[model samples]
Target: MILLLSLSFKNTPQKIREYFAFGDEEKKRLLLALCNEEPIDEAAILVTCNRTEIYISTHIENTNTLISLILKNCEDIIGMDIEHVRDYILCYTKRGAVSHLYKVSAGLDSMLIGEDQILGQVKDTIEFARECNTAHLYLNTLFRDAVTQAKKIKTETLISKSGVSTATLALRVAKDELSGFEGKKLLIIGASGKIGNIVLKNALSYDFSHIYVTKRSHNIDMSPNVRDRISIIEYNDRYQYIKDADVIISATSGPHFTLTKEHIKDNWDTESKKIFVDLAVPCDIDERIGSLDGASYYNMDDMKKYAVENNEKKKLSIEKANEMVKEGVEKFLKWELFQENWKVFSDATKSLEKEIARIGEKKTLEHLFYKIRDNGSLEALQSLIDTLSN
Candidate 1:
């Protein structure tokens, strides 16, 4: 059976969700361990700023053990009982699991509905699992089907017509606050992240006076088109450059705040206008910074309010997308049933081939045609011939 454990901004508070945020290395390690030590046959984990979903195929009858194993592993990150963890996560099995994945890939389950980034993220997670050899036929087929349907939904519906996300919204807000990007100095902390990179690339479209980016541990790889436009700054020196930036955005996976009130006090000019956007789960900017004069602060909660409004606007498209997801789920379930019976088909085909060899192909065909002619229609004979040829 296919199983899914979803912990997202929809159900989990930022305090609890932050503990489940796994870095790339952690994800790889967890994938390896799940396949190696647990009863899980296949595993793929999707980690984003808003959700951490674990998809797995397993034959374990009692799923509680597997669920407990996962929560136990996170004890070092956050000490929570199984009951407490259960309060935040939603688990799905079989058909429900398949449907959930379709909605997720189609971006219907996202905080920002119809955001384009999620489909790519879903694709990347399955690809990573394939690379680790943790995903086999079951998960590979399921994810591929989900991705295909997601692309179809995007093409057929007006779900993503607005093309809005926290990244785009942050840029829009920055542009509005600063009049325009033409003369503004932009500083992006945690530029290596998914949303942060989106913000960086989107900001590059406009003509900023100068753009600065900082990374904590991961390397920020800039493409040829953007290399000349951005200046790489050390993460520790972020506060030093605060005085020069008109817009500051931070999106990181870490639990700690990147911009604390104390850190900004020395560098912040009280009279200068500065816009701060925090796109992280646990939040990268200090809430106290909003109290500072001439500082505009926006966090995930602020982003969510905008997302709700965006979702409201796309209600019709969302309903259409949900119907598509339902159809995709039914199709996937049918395919899954076929896969379950595939070995039986293979064995039957092998047996027929052996029988045909024993009787000689010509003789077998003649006998089958004679029998069909006597008892069945010409169409039955033709069907038998086609089946044999196959």
Candidate 2:
């Protein structure tokens, strides 16, 4: 039996979803924990900013025990009551589990649907599961096929043509708060990071007077002109420039807060208001700093409202993408049925071979595989199924 437990933006509020969010390290631990449990034969963990899903295969036909255990144990992980968790979490079993994963990989389940990031995130999730040694045959096949479908969706449809990604939404939220960027000094921590690079690219259109970047090392891929526009600040001295910055974007990898109230020299007496953007999972900006006199803080969850406001609907493209997803799902279903039939096929083929070998004929299992597959049709398959039944 396969089961999936999902806590996502669709059912849960952003504030609530944030509590369920896990870092890569946390996800690894969760996968390990699940696999260690009784009857949970194999497991995989998928965690992104918008969703957290645990896919598990178990020998237990009844999932009530598993569900109860998860709710009781993961309360600390998600910071919610069992009843409340049940309200937000969607549980899928068997085929439903397979369909849910396909949609997620295809970006149909994303907060910003048709966005490109989820596919890569799915790939990373699979790789992480493999690294944890928790990715068994079931998950490996599911993830691989899901990726195949996602790529096909990208290739066959125009859903990603008008891309309005999370990075764009983050900048959009920032733009809404501050009317103009002219003469504004912007400080970007973790300038070499993924969201930081997007912020840097998007900020080019804004008429900021200067852009201050704090990175552990220089971004070597930057063009000469863009490089000229940015002043590289030492990672440790980032606090020194806080007084001079009108806008500070922190997307650093640091687990601890990069911008605390201590970094604020004056008590909101600055000429212009300070805008702090925290895009890190654990959050690079201290929440207490939002209490300062004249500062506004916006995290990824905070920007989701703005993300929806600017979201555009690609109806035709989405329909086409969904059509492809249906085909993908059918493909997976057929493949799963074939895998389930293989055990019977293997046993019968071996029996037939032994009878032939007793009469002085020898052939490898590889030969038997080729012989069956080369002429394998629905009729032949049904015959094999009949033989197994007999």
Candidate 3:
């Protein structure tokens, strides 16, 4: 039996979901932990700013027991109470689990419908699971099918035509707040990470006079076109550059705040308008900064209005995408059914082959044709033969 436990922005607030967000290493650890359990046969985890999904195949059919075990393990990893978040978890079994995954891969389940990032995230999650040896035949096939459908949806539909994401949305809001990025200085914290890198790449398209990125120890590899355009600042020096930045975006996997009110209180210039965006799941910026004069702070929850507006505009595309997802679900379910019955078909074929060897193929075919001609239709017999031959 396949089961899915999802804690996403759709049902859970960021305050709760943040506790479940795991970095790549932590995710791999959790995967190993789940796979270590006796009941869990195969498992894969998808962790994003918007959701944390655990897909598992188990021999145990009891949903409550499975959910409890999952929550307990998560608690052990992250130190959160299982009962505290039990109501927020969405559980799906068998077909529902498959359908949910397909929709999630297709971006239908995203906070910002038709966003382009979730597909890649799903792909990366499956790859990670495979690398950890936590994913086997069932999970691998499900993920592969989901990714294939997602690609087809993106190619055939205009759902992701704009290629919008949290990074782009943050930049858009910043541009709007500052009356455009021209003559502005931009700062990106945690620039070597995923969301930070996206913010860096998206910022390049704008007309900001200067762009600065913070790096801890890892070297940033920039494209030739933008290498000269960006300047690297040590992560420790981030506070010094904050006053000059018209737009500051902080996205990291760290547990603590990247920018706190105490650090910026004395440095911030109250006369100049500035935008502070935190795209991390646990949130990289302090909430109190929003109250600071001339400062507008935004976080993942703040992106909802923009996502809702985008979703409304793309209603038709979303409807079409959902239809495509439904079709994909049906096709995958049929394939799954075929896989389940394959052993039976193989055994029958082997038995038939043995019988043919005993009677001779010519004699067996003659007997079959005679029986078909007498009671069954010859056309049906020919179709069966053609199918078996294939």
Candidate 4:
């Protein structure tokens, strides 16, 4: 059985964050611990800002036991009762699991449909699993097929080209709100993540004069190409620049709010108009902060609404993507059936060959006697025997 277990922002995004807040080394340690406790064959974990999922390949027959094992592994990572999340968990087997993975890789399952970051995140997760020697043959083939299908869909369908993600849309909205970003000081919070990085890249593509990035760690160096246009700052000093900035974008993996009313109250006097785009799943900005004077906030759900509206124009492309998914599923099923049939045919052919050889040996001694008794007419006798065997 193949299982894809996900705990995301569905019921509570905080729970997902609490469970996966660890760094790469710690995550690897946790994975090893889980493997030790469970009957997992091949497993890969993908923990991101919005979701934490474990894709495992196993032969466990009891679904209840599998679910219990997963809960046990995650017991120490989350604050809530595992039973509370049990109802929301989704399970897939065989072809359904394959289809689900393909959809996820293609971003059809994303909150923001056609979001471009998921593909790379999926690739990274698969690569990490391979590096750790956790992925077996089944999962390796499954992930490789998913990645290939995703790329094909992206190139063949217009969904990715027609609809830009929330990050890029946020940049566009910022540009429009700030009037082409002329002489604007842009401040970006949580700059190391997928959405934050895309926002920074999109912002840089425009004419923004100055861009400042704030992250939890200050040890990492900024890219050389954008170092002139961007500056990195400590996470604690983020609010200081928020006050002076014309535009702000926040994409963090925190459980609670990163920007509160108290943080922005003091900054209201310095800026006439401030646009805050919160791309985080649970939202980094306090909802009430938008009520403050001279402040505007847009969260992920709002951006998703915009994306859905824009997707209407590209209905044909969506249809094409759906068709591609169907074709892929059909091809996989056909090949799988063919392999099963081929194995059956091979076994039957070997058995038939053994029976024919045994019969041939029995007839060899009889042939000489028949030839001697029938005045050396061995060719006619051989033909008769061959006909009877057939």
Candidate 5:
């Protein structure tokens, strides 16, 4: 059986974090241990801020053993009673697992519909499992196919156009608030990350004259085209640049607030009203920062509102994408079933051919003896036997 077990933030975000809070080395060690356990053929784990899922490929007879091993590993890592969280775990088998992965890759099961980062997260998790030698043939094929299908959907459908993503909505809000970003200084906190990088790309397409990016590290190198127009600053020096900027977009996965009320209180200049977009899930900017005298803030939930309102127009496209996903999953299942049956059919055919050869040999010997004993023509007897067999 192919099993997928997930504990998502939808029900227990805090608890999920506790299990994945360890460093990479520790996580790898734990994964190796889990893979070593009995009845676990293949094990791949995906741990993010919103979800923690384990995908396992094993025999149906070992289902109980696999589940118990997972529970034991979770208990060992979390050091707490996990029975309460078990109820929220979503489990899938075989075709259900395939369907769930397709839905997840297509963003249908995301917390925010049409979010684009989940696909990369899925790929990264799969790659990590491969690196650890914990992935089996089944999972490797399934994940590769899931990635291909996701790219196909993205290219063929309009589900990812316009307000298809929270990052795009954040950019739209920035443009709307700043009135086209012409000749403005945009301070982008956490610009080295995924959403931040996307926002920077969108901002560059606009009329912004100066783009300032800040992160925990100071190792960023500017491109030749925008070298003169762009500046890289350390995280600590963000306040120095943000005070003079006309717009600010913060998207960081840091545990705590990267932009606190105190930071905004001291650096915010009333002469220019700064538009801040927080695309981080936990949010980089504090909510109270919006209540400041001249500061405007938008969190992921707030950004999603704009996407939700505009998505109504693309209802048909979304429905079409859904249908495409359904058709794709059905085809995959049919092909998988055919593959399983083809082996059985081939084996049965070989067995039947061997039995027919044995019977034909016995009958040919009997016919030869009869022809020799009857002193008749061998050709006539062989022809008679051939006709009877036919």
Candidate 6:
């Protein structure tokens, strides 16, 4: 049986989702450990900012133990009780698990539907399992098929192209709000993240005079075109730069708020038209900061609102994507049937080989042994020669 348990952006709050999120090293360690223990024969973990899921293959009878093992592991991060964790977890078994992986790989299950990044993320999860020696034949084929189907969806449909991602919506709001985009000083609180990079790439076309990018080390790698308009600044100095910017995009993964109400001082000039785009899930900027005079704040919900506004155009493409998933699922089912058939075929082949060996042994051994009494140079009869006796 195949099983998947996930804490995702849908039907779960950010607070609960964080508990399930594992970094690369943590995921690898957990996968290795799970395979080492009982019940789980194979394991693959997918950990993204918006979701955390573990996919495994095991006997149906061991399902309860498998579920408990995962929940116990999650306790190390959130320190929450098993009953409480159960409320947030969504599980899928066998066919559902297989279908869920298909949706996730195609980005249909993403916070930003049809976002291109989740495909790479799915690839990473498979690769991580392989590196940990936890992925066996079932998972390897499952992931490979998922990737192939996702690519087909991307090429054959317009789902990704028709939708607006959170990163793109952030820029759209700024463009719509600002009078002139040229020479506007933009502050990106967490510029090294996936969404931040997308926002920056979109902002580049607007010709912002100076773009201030803040990361922990104030170090960033950029393409030649992206390098032209940005300056890397220390994260500590963000508050100082916050007051001097027209647009501040905050998308950090910090456990707490990176930009709080204190960051915007009471005496500070709030007359300047400043916009805050909080792409972080738990929210990098404090919600209360929106109360500051002339300041506008947009959280993930806000960004998603704008993204959904463009959903109508993607309706047709989304149907096409779903059709592709359905077709892919059929192929997967066929592959599963093939696996089952191979097992029976293999057993029969083994039995036939054994019978052939037994029949050959019964026919000619005793006479050969008696006749080869004092063999001098047995090279002449090499083709017929056999070690008849010890």
Better of 1 and 6 by TM-score: 6
Provide the clash count, candidate 3. 0
**What lDDT does candidate 4 reach at residue 49?**
60
Please, what is the TM-score per model?
A: 0.79, 0.80, 0.88, 0.76, 0.74, 0.80
- Expressed as tens digits, the lDDT of each residue in 232-294 for candidate 6 is 888888888877788889887676888888757743566688888888766788888888888
lDDT of 3 at 116: 82
Instruction: List ranges where model 1 is wrong by over 4 Å.
Output: 76-83, 173-184, 204-210, 215-232, 253-256, 343-390
How far does residue 97 in candidate 1 sit from its true spot (Å)?
0.8
Model 1 over residues 295-377: C-alpha lDDT tens digits? Answer: 99987656676677788999999999999999999999989888889998899678668869899888876775676779988
lDDT of 4 by residue, 1-390 (tens): 667777655444453345554556755765665666557777878766657777877767676777788777666655346676666666776678778788788877665566788899899988988888778676787788888888899988777785577688888777766678878889889888767877877788777789999877654346788789888888888878877788889988676888899776765754388888887755688878778777778775455555666667667877788778777766665555565489787986686567567777557556545655588567866766777799
Off by over 4 Å in 2: 13-19, 71-86, 217-222, 265-269, 287-294, 346-390
What tens digits encode model 2's per-residue C-alpha lDDT throughout 88-184? 8889987788888988998888767778888988999889999999888878888999999899887888766666677666666666778777778
The model with the greater lDDT, 2 or 5, is 2
Q: After superposition, how far is residue 287 of candidate 1 from its true place, in Å?
A: 3.5
Let me know the TM-score candidate 4 reaches against the reference structure.
0.76
Q: Cα deviation in Å at residue 40, candidate 6? A: 0.8
Question: For residue 200, what is the lDDT in candidate 5?
Answer: 75
Best by lDDT: 3
> For model 5, how does the per-residue alpha-carbon lDDT over 1-390 read when each residue is reduced to its tens digit?
568887664565443444544444655776787878867778778765456778887755556667778888877876777776677778777878887888778766665565677888789878988999988677787788887888788778776665345566676787788778778888888888777877777777778889888866554556798788888887888878878798888877675777888776777788777888776655577778888877788764454456556666657866877787777777777666776589887986686567568787677566555755598687866877787799
Error of 6 at 13 (Å): 1.7
Tell me which of candidates 3 and 4 scores higher on lDDT: 3
Q: List per-prediction Cα lDDT, in the order shown.
A: 0.85, 0.77, 0.88, 0.73, 0.73, 0.78
